[model samples]
Target: MKQFWIVGLGLLPLVAGCSLFETNPVPPSPALTGVSAQDAAWKDQIKRVRGAEEARFEPLVEAREAVSAALAQQGVNDYDAASLEEAQQALDAAESGWAEVANKRRPNGDKLAAIATDAHRATRLAEIARYAAVREINLEKLVAVNDQLETREQSQPTRQARPVTGDARDLVGQKVVPDQLGEVSFQPGTARMKPASQEIVRQLAGLLERYPSVGVAVFGHTDNVGPSAASLERFVKANPKLEQQAPSQAEKVRAFNLALSAARARTVAQLLVDNGVPARRIGARGFGDTRPVASNDTQAGRQANRRIEAVIVPGPDSPEAQRARAENAGS
Candidate 1:
């Protein structure tokens, strides 16, 4: 019986072979040739992305440098590993985002180009944000350390021996201190400081030298006579008033007036710096016809208003203020 059952076994093997032959082979997709139109488009996109990324690298590098400097200054000695990890993570994320966009096929190349441009901007902003975080963290650590030091100093005997002064310090926060006299005149328009006013600058410099730690602010002022913006423009130009134009043309006249005032302030600052005063100890600002000490309508008042002033800042001992007071007393 067993021998008889083997009769159809050969046919079964034949059926198995047929089944194997009938199995479907995978159909090949189009090959990615370098010279194809699609490849050209892809290359263009890559170029755009690469160009944008390259442009952003400089600012990113600067931000990173600033962060590194701040961290070092803050005494963050143990942050090397953490800093490296953060930088690597940022790079990885940027690369991954760029790759994802680069691999995509867009029907509108212009749109993708625009997107690449925006992505570059985004990356720059991200770098700034990241560096800002680093700075903030480092600053916090610095403040903490400083506070600790201050506390320790306060607990020491030296701090107890040194008595603190009760007088309030006069610290102006980046404000432009206007001249005591509102403005100066140079024959309706000119850069030259008036001969009579030259002594004023000499006096101011003498005052400044007495206070090495104090900073002075020299501000110029003018009378209102024209469109504010136009007057400011003309003032910067320092152009003289045209003889053909009426002197009553307040705008033109005021432009000359303010220009003279600004020149006076600059001259005073230069004189101070030239006399061994550090340049950082002085700041110059110009306000064209904005703040008037006297009425412009009256000739006497206007004459009084058109003048140069010197603001003497007192130093740690306010030596300049004291000297100024002594000179005033002597006068």
Candidate 2:
């Protein structure tokens, strides 16, 4: 036991010495450690480049989120692979841009500084370019998905004969008047329609009875108060909170306003369904502040913007209507 202890103690110094030597190994590149001043300058240059890259990438992330949301609207749930590929391409391009600046090592300090700045900007621009390209690709994919959905819908079985006098025939064509169905509201931030919206729903049912083939799309809109993605998230969250450290009165008011706007559309759709509007005939879609009918810069404008519009169209007999119905049924 004593000999074993002695042996272990003797080995400790060797292990420590090896670790010390490994840590202080000579750097291979002159660019790594030739001159302290040059090394510091190079580090500063790299820092600038990284800072610029971060700045550029931050907006790219936002763009990616926007594209992702658009994709989701078209029914895509995962885009990680595409996003990663885009980020890699951006990094590659940025690196190439940096290489060009690195190769032109000027003796003039001012020129070197300008070159570094330019390289940093170039890297940032590259990231932005990559994001733009990826967004375009995502948009194309979304369109393709929409097309597929349309095609699938078109292939659905249709009624062999159109009813000449029944409920089906009456709804073939009708216009949806917004004023007739008044004041729709829903539970704050929920898709469920409120009792107050029942009158409008009954009106919708009457319209359906009048024109059996007419289908209505319940479109929900909201005021533009925050980032589009954030607005959507908030709409989905179904809760209100302070925008920052402390709840500002203004922020609270805005949150309530937005919540009400979101609720209105949901309420309208639910009421329509409750009042005997066929679930298939009624399409519920939330725009979440994207398509604003009125300017959201003012209170009046926000009020006007936060509305539910029921766009009426030809029912199952119409090519588009039939296709959509079929797709929904199959889905």
Candidate 3:
């Protein structure tokens, strides 16, 4: 049997087995223009990093990830600790200026601008360092390696790629417009779906079962009533009969609105799985009131906001895809 393993990241391979790991070159961060990496800021950072013509691709991409991690608090910034440290200094200055404002003093805008410029330069230098480290420091080795590459390129021209059949559209993954199960909703202050919502997802779950390659994403939302933690607390207090069967601790609610949103999303995801959708293909998240479709002050508007929306994320067939596939296979 072909296995589809899901790791902690919630992303898995669209296909299984050795069709993955085919001799593909890791061309760089253009590797993910996919749904998950669609943020404008992320694309801008990637473009700036990949613009280094003189540097090898791997080192530049690796360095970009290092800066990203340090800023995001995910891991250590071993690529350029000093630049990362300097960037942090800018943040410290901004924080200090804000503190002065609390004391009735003028806030410093210069420090904030400096932070932006400093971060940009740091990221650029991180990419440039890859080329400088090899070419400027080890001139003899660089020249020797260049000579070998030039000779090879001259003697053997690049081969033409094999042509694929059908239209170009057929080769890429399809992204369908998300069907939002119109008027679907949850009971007030709880994750329990009304009957209409259940019927809609049941049909969607069947469609997902029919299309194994299509991926489903569930985003939970709230009506801006309050934070998710507080909302969840209120729900627990009011609905003691249902609290016993509630989902496990999220550990990181921070606020109640988000907590309620998450609970609703998990509820929807579970319902879909029970209906027929494969668990591995479903990814869930809570948007709270951040992405409200209507104003929260009105009852109708609040009702609209308190709903779940699902999208079918298209799979990207790239080096990253292959790596994800490899990781899934291993898992």
Candidate 4:
């Protein structure tokens, strides 16, 4: 009876209603949608990037970051549109190369080399774009400041014209080069004016005192000589155009010279103030090694380059303007 029961149980699976021997088909995987689909794509990209990085194509990663950083900065596209566009194209090429390499079981060495070259170029261009953008922004600020100064000058009350004579006559109508008026000298590299410079300063102060309505702009300049490495680096970082045009020390020296020239201008302006010239009538600035009257290759030329210039701008009621008006009236 027990054996008959066992046989019956074994035959049960063969019966139509029994499901023990039949296998169940797995349900189709749910279609990926929304966040899951996006997540999958991101994971795939991450895997490819990881593969690229492991294959020693890290420069591409750096280039991508650099391009992204440049785009993030203000006015990059506006100031350096050409460089930015080129950088983007180079980066795209590098990335495409990387994708092709990553997809293959074995990456070609020549293709990897090309990708690296493109990545390096993209990085350099991106850096240049950022530098140009910042420089243009600074220049715009300077122009705005100059406009404000002009506005302030226009707001001042008109004064009666005064008589001009001697040194004042020579200076009032033109940009007075300090070398023409007994060169303004400084003590070594310092901003302190030497005793020899006193005569020039006195001459300028006297001219300003004679015509109170006349405004003077003092410009100081220097030769290309001494500059610290750090300062040079900073200058290169700030002025990419300069570095691109003149990579030598001649251009880098401007970084140090700029500060020295500014100080010298201020010193001269201060001296004029001490000699009774109104501070309001004076504006001081520096040109560094940019505007050289002579070549910096020679000592005399460098000495000529390192000097102060005063530009006297006569107001509507100034002596020079009055002289012009009187001459016109007589004619």
Tens-digit lDDT string for candidate 4 (1-331): 2232222222111111111111121222234457656344323333334534444456677788889989997899897889889999999998888878765655555676677678878888887787566545533443344345435545779622223455533434344544246578898667988897887889878766666656565778898886567756775777777668766675466666887898888888788878987654555667788767688899999898888876555433455445544664585
Which residue runs of candidate 4 sit more than 4 Å off their true CA positions?
1-171, 177-180, 227-252, 315-331
State the lDDT of candidate 2 residue by residue for 46-113, as single tens digits: 32244443322222233344334434332222323344345345444544444455434333444443
RMSD of 3: 22.8
Pairs with backbone N, CA or C atoms under 3 Å apart (clashes), candidate 4: none
Scored against the true structure, residue 235 in model 2 reaches a CA lDDT of: 42
Quickly count the clashes in candidate 4. Answer: 0
Of candidate 1, the 10-residue stretch with the lowest lDDT total is: 10-19
RMSD of 1: 31.1
lDDT leaderboard ranking: 4, 3, 2, 1
TM-score of each predicted structure versus truth: 0.36, 0.36, 0.39, 0.41
Q: What value of lDDT does candidate 2 attain over all alpha carbons? A: 0.45
Q: Per-model C-alpha lDDT, please?
A: 0.42, 0.45, 0.47, 0.62
Off by over 4 Å in 3: 1-180, 227-254, 315-331
10 residues in a row with least lDDT, candidate 4? 12-21
